[model samples]
Target chain A: MMAEQISIFIENKEGRLAEVTAILRDAQVNIRALSLADTTDFGVLRLIVNDNDKATAALKKEGFTVGKTQVLAVEVTDEPGGLNKVLDPLCEQDVNVEYMYAFANPQCKNAIMIFRFDDIDKAKEILAQKDIKVIDGKELSGL
Target chain B: MPIFDIDFETMPREGLEAIQLRRLQTTLERIYATVPFYKETYDKAGIKPTDIKSLDDLRRLPFTTKQDLRDNYPYAMFAVPMEQIVRIHASSGTTGKPTVVGYTKRDIATWAELMARSMSAAGATNGDIIHNAWGYGLFTGGLGAHYGAERLGASVIPVSGGNTKRQITIMQDFKPTILCGTPSYILHLAEVADEMGVDFKDLYFKSGIFGAEPWTEEMRQELEAKCNLKAVDIYGLSEVIGPGVSIECVEEQKGLHVFEDHFIVEVVDPDTLEPLPYGEPGELVFTSITKEAFPVIRYRTKDITSLNPTPCTCGRTHVRMNKPTGRTDDMLIIRGVNVFPSQIESVLMETREVAPHYQLEVDRIDNLDTLTVKVEIDETSFSDDIKGLQAMEAKLSHDIKEHLGVSARVALVEPKTIERSQGKAVRVIDNRKL
Candidate 1:
């Protein structure tokens, strides 16, 4: 299932990450998972927060450019071949994984991995056919 | 036409010309006798001060340029001795030198009086509190306006430039009636005020006398709506006695009325050097007639503008000049500080991280002029990490501000992102039409 994520454009400067985190903290929004993609000039910070509306409103009020995106949240086995199991089907189905990150789920027993795919619907269909556990936006953000 | 001759400012055109001719002759004689540069130039042209019997004959004199001022250097252009000079102001010159101008006691008095008259024309009264943000020191706008405001018996707050937040607080606290600064800086102030949740409509500002940089009617409307004041244009150059050379009346913000009593103004074709008739746009030239210390004769200002001889509705009979549209040179005035592209080039060339290729982009962002130096990333300096590139950008930006006294955002573009001409890459991309 698809989970919603937020991306923010931040200048490559000191304490920007800390500043962003401080805003989220003051807004009382909890960050569930995050990934940062950086280039020479700037960085795009992706965050899975408990409240997208609150986080976006707070960050935007502080003049941060915020954007919303859709990413898949997959629950893989906590074992060593956990990620390999999901990748094996995705690779066989000719799916492209643009980027991905993982975190231990406090809500469930298995580990949760977030993925950004070129063709998200194709990847979702492939995972659904394989009977892999895919967490929805509400459940993934809560974890 | 019932013309008011009660004041020196609104004298009839014929009467003004007669006074101008007498002053011009006097200035010519003084400069010829005092400054060797003028004496030599006048002698080289085989002309003498007495030869300029009429204003028409004054056109026969050779034009003085910024290069001429540079040739004289520190004080050779001073018509009076050092003992008589009271103040000196300078504008940016080529290759790091400055175009120096000195004012004697009388020259200073003249400047103050003219400035006061200019303020009066802008609807500023002695009761008004003027928040002067034009940077003081060598820049003539600050002190020139200060003395003028004082002369007019106005409460002058010499809050010279920068400290944006503090300026906002001062505005809210003092409730100044008049704002005197470059339009760009005033725009910046309004923006800062908005950020601080202080509205100008809630403040006591009634008029803004903006000068030192070219601004548009659009900017005028923007500032008026934002600051709740009438925005009027004031024109001046350091060589021509600073910020009191001309000003627009608040009642009729059509054109700036040139104070022809002090300076004999002229317009000439920049390319051909032929005098342009009134109502035709050309390079502005001035002969500072009443100036005692540094009286200039037909000084080419290189500012593109036209002259309007028609009388203004404000009852000032002085000929009005169109707001300066552009400069004939590559000089860029950022926040009333003049910056040339070559100056930026020297700063960028000093940095080993960036290649020699660069372009300067100037845009008015939120009413403040912003300079962006787009430097080509050299292959050797190209790094995979964002921190290093950002550091390089910071360094370049710092160096530019340190050297040029103007803030700039340094951007490292791709190797060949900047379009290159057949000969050299295009240097400046100015988006501010004003």
Candidate 2:
């Protein structure tokens, strides 16, 4: 199933992350998997959160430029070569992976890895054909 | 259907020269008789107005620089008395004392005719609805274009500058067929149109007359592609008679045709003051042959451009001038390499990731001169790819080196980071000497 990630554009300076996290704290939103893409002048902080609407509105209220992107949550084995399983068929099928990150849940046995592919629909079909479990947005957030 | 002032515009080369000589002599005599500054300068040079027998004799006159106007200040440069002078305009004086210029009732009527000819050449007509966005009052761009549009018999909307959102709405409702303003403000209007979800193409504009600042060909292509209209270059300054001094015909956008009937144009080597042959780039020097209140004698414009005496597709015989590269005052000498802000603007216009709004900062770091380009990143170009962002900066810096043979650091900031000026943008900041 499809999951959504929020991206916030922040200028490169002190206490920006602190201010962001404080806003999220006051809004009572929990972040799941997050990755920060940064350059010398600015950065984009991507996050999967429990309440997407709440987190987005809170961050935007403080005048931060925010964006939303679609991502996929897939199950990966905990041990050796765990990540390679997700990459193997997708590479053979020519499904490009733009970016990915992972998060662990207490109720789930295996780790849930988030994937952002060039073609998310093709990546979904490739994973489903291989019988890999893909978590729904509601299911992942509730966990 | 005929071009404006067909007889004069298409006059044979010999006849045009004869008229030019007659007008030039009359102007020289008037200035020598009335204006003390011209009388003193010409007297010191041991040349009288009658000595200018042919068109070539104009070379013997001295060059009048902008400092001369600034030195005279308010009314000392006027060739006519205050009773005849009806209007006065002054430069912004950003560097110090402002240079002032005056015009009489007859001069204003002549200015209207010249500007009307300039507008018609740029494809405006009596049937066209002209949206004049050039600032009015103290600045010549506004009233200069306004009087011309009225003279052209076109329905003119003197919206002036600013009030962009309302202007866009007026554009949709009033349905203007032509636009007149600076190139940068026109582009800014296009951007605002995009944000307002109003397509510029929907405005149904056929042509735009843009000038008062140097713009490159690449920028013209961008403005044309984005604004969906024929972009014509109109050249003028407050000191010369404002927005009607010269303009490019809509039929041939290649070069701007100077109104030789009223003014004489010469390209000269700025260093040696020797006039250069046509096709050689040099500082543009203009001599007002028909100005009554303020007659300029071989005034140096400090703008770098070449003259083309060849015939144009539109069939006018007046000499054409290539688009100016940059003003001498705006050129940045970086590490002994001359770089113009327009060159940097051309580079910025070439890429989609960067917006057209930018500022160049020159400084001395570690005893070596450095150039830094601060460009505003387009909102649509922002992405989560950190490597791609750095790569974009690298590509811009590399392009600057390739285009200008000078190294520079490119900084991409957030959208709207750079402040937009109501008038012309202050594009350069030199921190080295200061």
Candidate 3:
């Protein structure tokens, strides 16, 4: 139910984002879904990657401040109201979503969304009750 | 240019030493008969006022330190009665209690005379208007310059620090010939004046007597270039008598002439406390021979500088002290505010999320000193949430500012990022040369 996400701390300078991606590419790590949160001075590059440990090690080796975060990958209906359908039940159960990003899975008619929640275990239990498919780390990475 | 006091300013060496000896004898006698702290210190050293037969024999006395002042607290070191004490000034003790100094009426007059001499040495005349930007209240810089300018018969604008734009407006309106403040503040004012489309060169500022903190010769060059005035370095400490202890003559910017008639200056090796030869850098020590209220005997200033015993080209026979290179203490003077690493460490220790690993970096950006605090985040408190980490940085910065009364940018680095030392950690990285 829990998925491992790699987060890299980067100074808000030109080419920093590209540098991180280059490091990942050189390490042969696939970035499945990504989001960037930035402020005036610095940015946090969050990635749902195919190889979390390998990507983190390579980024850290390149002197990037990197950390591993536990998130959730859920398969939702590839429809207009799919995100809202998955969010409505979690909101009702008082499960807070910190941040989320999505990517379309080509093999299935569904979208895979990576979610960081305040309580990942509570989020998994609520999603199970709602019958929404919560994908494992291996399945998500393979997709 | 008219000299402030012809008799003392151009005094011969023998005559100056005779005056220093007489005053030193009287000062020792007064301190021994009045302050118990000095009496105890002198008695413990098995020395008395009668034992001082010559100026060189004065080295037998025990050296007083900042901790000694703190132990005395407010008024324990005053050699005169409270009725005779006229004014009091203090150092901003960031680590502990403020070191206080009281002034008798005669001591105040002496301070004014020394400041007058300082202003005259820097080419300020009675007709010149002075804009004093040093802070007032208990701090000695503002009022010290104010009274000295007034004593020199110069009209003074008591615009004590801050309000950069307004200071420029006053400068434009008042047309003051002299500016008195820290060197950094004067440079900052020049930048603000430039931003306002007012050229400092066009202003009436002829000379600037900058002090209250250690500054470099490079900063002096920048200040002179930016302000279009002769930038003079004035050195003093509240423990001595404020900003007129020594002043650089405009004729020669080599070193500051110490007013030997009032204060005796010595340079000693900081490690061994042994007196260093002239022209060799060491810790500066001052013994106030003429101060009546709170005279310190062989007080350790912790400032690292040497003395030039040769006569100055300006014709002042008194000894000249070179600009201080650094301090013997861990104190960091940031933007004219005193900051200690222990204070920052204590503030960081108050928070559980931060590790004890920290470093203080002091740098100059645009002529103003900026302090940046780099601390390691504890492994348990580490989070990928950017907002949470930013909040922690903000909270730590706020705490430091609140406790230390100085603004510092707080940087949260990864744990073990700061290099650990085997013995003592290198806590401060000061990029500002002095």
Highest lDDT scorer: 3
| Per-residue C-alpha lDDT of model 2 across residues A1-143, encoded as one tens digit per residue | 89888887777878888888899999999988788877777888899999999998997777665678888999998889978888999999899988888888668578988888999999999999988889989987898
Q: Give the per-residue lDDT digits (tens) of candidate 1, residues B1-434.
A: 22112378878888988999998888888888989998999899999999998999988999999999999898999887899998989988754678999998988889999999888888887888999998998989999999999988899999999999999888889989999998888888888889889988899988899989888899899899999999999999999999989988888899998888898899999999999999999999998889999888899998999999886788888899998889899898988999888888877777766788899999988877888898876446654335566888899999988877889998876556578789778999999766
Candidate 2 lDDT, tens digit per residue, B315-421? 89999999987566676655434466877888777876677878898876643467899887654666666677788889999987876666899987655556657
Error of 2 at B147 (Å): 0.3
DockQ of each: 0.04, 0.21, 0.26
Choose the strongest candidate by TM-score: 3
User: Which residue pairs show backbone clashes in model 1?
Assistant: none
**Candidate 3 CAPRI assessment class:** acceptable
The residue ranges of model 3 lying beyond 4 angstroms of the native Cα positions read A1-72, A89-96, A103-107, A117-130, A135-143, B74-76, B80-88, B92-97, B420-424
For model 3, residues B341-397, the per-residue Cα lDDT tens digits are 988988888887777889999998887889999886554555679899899889999
Please give the CA lDDT of all the candidate structures: 0.86, 0.84, 0.87
Better of 1 and 3 by TM-score: 3
Candidate 2 at residue B306, lDDT? 98
Q: Please give the range of 10 consecutive residues that has the lowest summed lDDT in model 3 chain B.
A: B375-384
Question: Which portions of model 2 miss their true places by more than 4 Å?
Answer: A1-143, B331-434
Q: How do all the candidates rank in terms of lDDT, highest first?
A: 3, 1, 2
- Give the clash total for candidate 2: 0
